[model samples]
Target chain A: MIELCKVTAAYQEQSILENCSLQVSSGEHIALMGASGVGKTTFLKLIAGILPPISGTVHVSAERISYLFQEPRLLPWLTAAENVNLVLSDSEKTIDEAHHWLEVVGLAGAMGKYPDALSGGMRQRVSLARALAYGGDLFLMDEPMAALDDTLISQLLSLLHQYTQGKTMIFVTHSLEQAKIISDKIYLIKNKTLELL
Target chain B: MNRRWLKQVLAMLFWLGLWWGMAVAVQRPILLPSPAAVFLRLTDFIGQPDFWVIVSSSIWHIMLGILCAVILGSILAVLTAQFPLLDLMLSPLLTTVKSTPVASFILLVLVWIGRDSVPSIISGLMVLPVVWSNISTGIRNVDAQLIEMAALYRLRPYVMLRRLYFPSVMPYFLSALKISIGIGWKAGIAAEVLTVPANTIGKMIYESKLYLETTDLFAWTLVVVCISLFIEKIIIAALGRLDIQHGRKVAASDD
Candidate 1:
């Protein structure tokens, strides 16, 4: 379960998400939809605790949170497999787990390849694999599927439905079809506020 | 086949041809030695035990100075990057060292320190600022998003330094090292010449200059160039190997 009570986050003096409140029970999938520059990404950053809200109380049942940024943000110097391995904690099991995740994301054969060699969709899949590899209770994705084609997006959505239904996920995206496909609940976010749609 | 080696050979031949022509125009071995004269002098010097002693001594001091500079400069760079106030305080000192003439430093060190220590001190001082500035920039310019990811993941300090900071800094550090080693060799040799240290390459060059042994001077200069080039190649090759090793480790970890 996660709750953002009267959150007010801003950059400099300008507010992006102002006095916004949201709550998601455990195992709930919520999609936050909004137009461009409407704080959709900002909200995820706040929830992920990367940015502190100026005025708010965020309560999370779980301490660990996995966030997938809009960009893959994979280290260019690291191979795709290494990027996935970076998140795992267990030394003895990390390699096996990384391999498992890579296979899960259909990147099994390209483990030795660097990020530059991979296509956009493949890089995003690697990022998704990294996030999933972390195995956090609350998953926060900030428009992770924005770069993929419709076919890849549908495949990713289906994968998301299989792996994340039993876990709490707050997905922020602009695609209404995607929201309808995977989200148990969709919130029409606008003007630094959310209206349940 | 690599064109790089061919280009280098051609360039060397062109310069040698020009030098030969200039020597011919001068028409006096005492004034300027031809390529053949320098080569013969080089062969004679190579056969002398004393020449080897001088070359080895100068190389030892220069290499030691470079080692000291690399260690201290890298440490200082890391410290200053962590503390802005320290960086601010140290910036002027680095600038002063950088701006001060090599001859000035060599002369000053001669008066204040032993003749043997002057070249080493001068060489170390010459390399310090180059290393500091380059490494500092490298640290500052590390990918912010990767750092954020590391922070978010709670990566251990050792892992973060090894995996992130070192790789990011390697390229900058190598560039600085190449520049510093080249400059340090020149400054170190110059210091030796000025100080006239016994059993050193600079002393040989000084003796040759004083006696108008132009061929010997050219030969010693060739030796210095050869040594510097050799060291630079070794350093670059070692850095390349390290890069490959780092890449392999990262990949292996993923598997």
Candidate 2:
């Protein structure tokens, strides 16, 4: 469940989101579509409690949150599996869990490989694996499938659909097809406010 | 064997030959002892029981100083990075410490602590500023995006440290250790030479100089160099093992 009543977010003098309001019930998957520099990432950040609203209020009623950033943001020092394991608890089981997620993301062979050794798509999948391994009720993803091809994106989307069942999600993307596939409702950012389509 | 190894061996032999020629020309053992004489003196030292004791004692004192400096420097770096006021206050003091001569610190510490403790304290003082500056910069330079991801996941404090902070700061920490170890060890020995602590290599060097035993002085100085190199190799080996175990193969694959 999420709620935002007239949330005005800004970075110093530059306003990203102005007096924007939105509400989503539990288990709702919402897609946010916006042009470049249009604050789609800012909206996700606001919901994930990364950025504070300059003037209004935002609330997210979730026990845990998993965020997939635009960039992979994987720890370069950690191997692909180790990067996923970073979000998991320290246990033998967690190692297996990390491996499982990496496998699900089609990175079974790359489990021992470092981020630097992996391609851009592979790295992004590793980041996705990490987010999925975290196992959160609320998922905030910013263009998570941007690096993958259409076939891979479809496969991953199906996997995501199964994993995120009954979980609340706020996905940001430019692809209308992806927006339709992953989200129950679609909202576009226009003129500094969320416009439902 | 290989080209590089052959080149290195040749270079070493060339230096040794030049040193032998100079000693033969001088023929004054008091001013500059022959290489063979110094080597024989070192062999005699190696056979003595007192040599190991002296070597171990110096190692203990300098290592203790280095360890203390590492711990305290890391803590201070974290604290200063967290609090701007603390950073403002510590900036000038650390800069002063960095710029101050090793002999100055030795003298100042001599007035406060006993002769035996002077080496440890002086070495710690010598190392602290470098460790602090490097680690503070590392902390400040951690990738912001990774930090945001860590926060979003609500990672435990210790987990965050082990996973995020440690890896991010490791290169800087290792660089600080490499630089500061040499500086600290040299400074510690200098302190010992001044203080003339009992049963130390520094004390033996001083006594050798006082008695005009040039061969003994050269032998003791060689011991110092050998030990410094040995310690550095051991540390680098240990850190390399840690890096391997942690899967930090970035440096190797960086090229």
Candidate 3:
């Protein structure tokens, strides 16, 4: 579903990912982990076709991909329900599905609230709801539940497990338990390249 | 609300009383007519058909000017935001328009385009810069992340503009409209006074000054102020149809 062949990426003149290469087959789920400022983000950006590699190439075969950025990245002007609805293609069914997703993510009461009105954990949950509502063939999540407490994580882990089935997911996360639960393969960004673990 | 109205009434009465006292002190109608005389003149003119004709003509011209300026300003702002070359070339011209006096524009345009086009052209000139600068800033200030999201989602360009750009730019555009309306009125009237259009509020005021009728001059000036306020209210109400009406008073307190 995705391939990066010796892809070197950078911001300005400084190289962040040097000769980084990875491949994920169809229906493959993977977790990418690394130390702070180790270019885990650049790897995702390359796969998602957001950043151009300074050298080599990137290939993504998935036509529909849902990406949950490290930040919630909700349109602050839009209500939580509206933010969820943004990614839904069918306008006629969007409202009901948005409300349903928000409810599933434990944000039923806060659907009308704006991102600024929600707490950090609630905002992340709303973002998760948006990604779920998108219903894409592939998912690229950057620490999808980093803001939630252990209790909330455990509660919502079922929701994640349910929706992520039969699709490729490349999730960047810190928690080993989270990586283990969701990923079929784990890789670490070691010395500017993906290393299988 | 009642207390606020009372405070406003008292403030108005204080000024009106002071004007009456000054009129009495002067005791010369030609030099300084009493407020009563000006009010009488105002009522007399309101009864005349010519007054309405003149007022309506001025209103039509100014409205056309404002409308044209808004359309052209929005187009220019979009182009300038999209192309660096356009921004570089157009910046100095707008700066010159902003800095140049209304009288200068009146004289130059009167000579170039004749008196028929003066009021509308001058008014458009006054409004264009304000609208362009404001909308340009609004376009430039859109959140980069939202734009990226829109791109990734493959949102159509027009849809992206409607959903993201319009809502973001509305407050700035509305504010510019408010300021431009005032400038448009002032410059429109100034242009009319210079060019002496056949039927206009400025023509009536100019004639009053020529005939030494101070009461008529003051009455016409008062009429201009009233009309300016009325049109501003009407235009503001019209903006509500654009789905960005609340943007005028929008101050997001989201924390």
Candidate 4:
């Protein structure tokens, strides 16, 4: 289980989360829904350990945490396969493992292609493959499929559902339908506090 | 490669024809050696044992000096990017170096260093400002969002450099390298000529000029041009290889 106790995080003087508290258990998918710029991404960042709270405690039982950024931050110089390979260990075995993940993400044919040659949906899939291949127990995603078309987004969501069956995911999105599709629990941000529903 | 080769060959032939026409019109070897005369002189120089020594020595010094300058300039750029105070402190000195005439520096270096080392020193000095400015610009222009992404991922320092910084700075760095190498060659040779460094191409050119050996001077000039072009080709090829080895294909996902 992961728990946030009295999490108070702010940017400069602008307080984004104030005394925000939440709990997530293993095998649970939580959707954090809030309007744009209402600190949803900030909350995910804090949970990812990318940002430390001003005064709070976060406890995680997961061995590893992998974050899928809102933007697909693939290195431009690498082919899709090589980009995934970079995050893997240098040995041939680890590389083959990374390539397997690319295939799992439905990027098998596109592995040797550069990101520029891939569609937006394809790029996101590569990013998704990278995060998942890291073998993290907990996945923190900030709008991972926001750029995809409706059909592509649905396909990816279904893939996520199958692949992340036993993993814990704390994903932020403004799409209520997407939250309903993937999340077992929903945390909606209103004003400055999270309202668990 | 074929397209480029054809283009370059055509351009060279056109220029060579122009030079030949000008030489014919002037009809004075002292003023301008004909293309044929220069070719003959080039063959004569090739037969001399000292010719290879002079060319190789100058290449050695210039290459070493430029390499050192590039390394130092890149390190300095990284430091300055991290600390603004260091940049402010060094800006005046770098600007002075950039603004100063190459001739003045050549003369000063001749007095300060031995004649043999002058060309290398001059090459290093000429390359520094060009590299520093370009690298600093590259550092400053790195995508802010990528840095944020690196922060979000908690990327290690070396990982950040490999994934974020190197790809961003590469184009600017390559361009700076191109510009710096050309300038370094000219400045290094000029320094050598003025200093008359023994067993150096610049010294050979100086000797030819002293004896009014216009054909010899032209031959040496052609040798310098060929070497410079060769170096440029090698550097560009290396840069291309780096792009491939480093795997810097631009991602479609960039905002």
Candidate 5:
């Protein structure tokens, strides 16, 4: 579903990745594991069409992509349900889908609450619900569950697997256990390069 | 009412009590009218048809000015935010407007436009820079990560504005309104006073001063202050309601 050939990216004078390459087949789940600030997010951004590589080609076959940011990034004025519904094209089905996703995320009671009224974990779940309600073939998540608790994490891991079944997903995480649970293949970001594991 | 609003009301009453004490000490209605005297004068003024005509005209002109300024300023802000070159070109001109004295503009405007239009024009001019700058700042302050996500999802422009920009920019816009409305009132009245337009509070004030009716002058001044405070309180209350809806304080500086 995605390919990056000899990608070279930088932030001003400093290089984040050099001579890096990655490829993902259709419906394959991939995890990029790394320490803090190792450009895992950058690589994901490259595939997600947010960051253009300095000197490489990135190709994404999937036309529809849903992204969950590290921060919840919910609109402060929007209700939790509205936040999810915003991702969908206007339809009666969108409202039902948004409600369903909120229910799946354990926020059925919070549909009317704005992001400001939500706790951190609840906001993150709202973000996750937004991504899921979007109904895309490609999913890119950057440390999406970082703010979640262990119980919530396990619940979401199961939901993520169910929702992302037969879809291409690229996620970044710090935990090996999380990577193993979600990803069919794992890659570590280190020394300004992606190392297959 | 909130505690903060109650506290502000109490503070104003304390100052008013001091003013009443000072008026008692002076023991002269001409030099300094007592609060009761001013209140009585205000009641009489309110009952007059001429006073209503003047107040209503002033309200219409100033509100029109502010509306025009807000519309033009928001358009300018969006243009400037979208284009750096426009921002670069307009920065100095806006800064000049900000830095120049209000009296200077009023004088020049009085020459160009008639006295009837001066108050409205000056009020609009005074308000333009405030709305433009604050809205531009709000646009610049939008979160980068959210933009990235927005791009990845391919949100439509109107949807992007509704879902992102409105929430982010509303507080800044309200803060700009809170500040610029006062400036508009001040500039509008100053223009009216200088031009001596008919059916205006400023004209009444100018006439009272010319005839040495110090009590009337004090009364007019008190009316202006009261009206300004009332309008400001209403705007701030509406803004507070918006803050409650959005779930975040504006974080705008009071000044």
Candidate 6:
């Protein structure tokens, strides 16, 4: 579902990922582990088509993609349900779909709350719900549950595992435990390239 | 709230007492009328049917100018933000308008249009640059991450505008509106006074000055201030309601 061939990504003139190559087959779940500022996000952005490689190629077969940014990035003016609904088709059913996804993420009581009124963890959950409600064939998440408690993270991981059954996912995380629970395979960024572990 | 109101009342009374003392010291109503004399003149003017006509006519002209400025300024800001070439082209013209004195514009506009239209044109000119500058900055300052998220979701253009752009720019837009309204009113009244348009508060002020009716001049000036404050209150209240509708907390004083 995703392929990269000698992709070299850089910011300005500094190379973050030099000649990095990776491939994931359909319905594959992969976890990317890396230190801060080590180009894990750079890799995801390349696949999500947000950033272009300075060298080589990247191919993503999925038509629809759902990306959870490192930040919640919720519109301050929109309620939790509305933020989720923002990614969905504008229909009455989508409203219920947004509410349901928020409930699934344990934000049932916060469906009507604005981003300012929400805590950091609550906001991240809303962001997660928005990504889930988008219903994309491929998901690119960058430490989406970093703000949550361990129990909530486990519950959310279980929910995510059930939800993304037939979908391709590449998640970035710093926690080895989370990585082991979430991915079929684990890859770490070592010296500006992916190393399987 | 009541304590605050009482404090404000006391402050106002202090100023009035000082003004009365100064009027007595001057001993010339023509130079500085007492507050009571001005208030009595205002009451007399209010009883006249022409008073409402004059007030309404001035309000209509100034309000028309403000409305036009708001519409055109927003359109120009959006277009210029979208097209850098347009921004480049209009930059000098807006700068010229901003820098030039209001009196110069009033005279220039009077030469081009009728005296009655001069106030509106000058008012619109005074307000346009402020609105354009603030809104364009607002557009530029919208959170990039939010914009990226919107794009990744492939949100429709109108949805992006209505949901993302509108809310982000609203605070800046409201700030511009608040500021420009005061400028528009001041510039419009100054234009009217200079041009002496028919059936306006400016015309009455001018006539009172011509006949040395200082009390009438004070009363007319008071009317202008009152009307300006009233209009500003209405606009702010309306914008506060809009903020509420968008689920934003409305600050008591956005300024």
lDDT of each: 0.87, 0.90, 0.86, 0.85, 0.86, 0.91
Give the per-residue lDDT digits (tens) of candidate 1, residues B1-255.
579989999999999999899999999999888999999989998998888888889999998998899999999999999999999999999999999888889988999998999888989999999999999999999999889878766667887887788888988998999998999999999999999989998998999999988888999999999999999999888987897776733444443
CAPRI rating of model 1: acceptable
Query: Model 2: runs farther than 4 Å from truth?
Result: B1-8, B25-27, B250-255
The alpha-carbon lDDT assigned to residue B132 of candidate 4 equals: 91
Per-residue lDDT over A82-171 for candidate 2, one digit per residue giving the tens place of the 0 to 100 score: 889888975556899999999999999898788888899999999999989999999998999999999999999998899999999999
Q: lDDT tens string, model 1, A146-171?
A: 88998889888998888886899998
State in Å the error of residue A75, model 1. 1.5
Q: Which portion of correct inter-chain contacts appears in model 3?
A: 0.14
DockQ of 5: 0.40
Which run of 10 residues does model 2 chain B get worst, by summed lDDT?
B246-255
Model 3 off-target regions past 4 Å?
A: B1-34, B244-255
Q: Is candidate 4 or candidate 5 better by TM-score?
A: 5
TM-scores of chain A across candidates: 0.95, 0.97, 0.94, 0.93, 0.97, 0.97
lDDT of 6 by residue, A34-143 (tens): 89999888888899898999999999999899898889999887788889998896556689999999999999998877887788999999999988898899999999
DockQ of 6: 0.49
Which residue pairs collide in model 6, if any?
none
Candidate 4 stretches greater than 4 Å from native: A1-19, A52-63, A150-152, B1-4, B139-168, B248-255
Q: iRMS of each prediction in angstroms?
A: 5.0, 3.1, 4.0, 5.7, 7.3, 5.6
State every prediction's TM-score relative to the real structure. Answer: 0.95, 0.92, 0.91, 0.87, 0.92, 0.95
Candidate 6, B117-190: lDDT as tens digits: 99899889999999999999999999999899999999999889888898889989999999988999999999
* Local accuracy of candidate 4 as per-residue lDDT tens digits, B1-255: 999999999999999999999999999999899999999989988999988898999999998889999999999988988899999998899989989999999999878777788888999998998899999999999988667655644567787788678988988899989898899999999998999978998998899999999998999999998999899889988996896567664554244
Tens digits of lDDT, candidate 3, B1-255:
999999999999999999999999999999989999999999999999898999999999988898899999999999999999999999999989999999999999988989988999999999999999999999999889888777776667766776678888877887888888888999999898889999998888899889998999999999988888888878866875564432222235243
**What is the fraction of true interface contacts found in candidate 2?**
0.65
* Per-residue accuracy of model 5 over B1-255 as CA lDDT, tens digit each: 699999999998998999899999999888888888888888898888888898888878877898899899999999999999999999999989988999999999888877899989999999999999999999999987677767777789888886688778888898898888889989888888888988988898889889988877888887777777788789879877866655353222111
Q: Name the candidate, 4 or 6, with the larger DockQ value.
A: 6
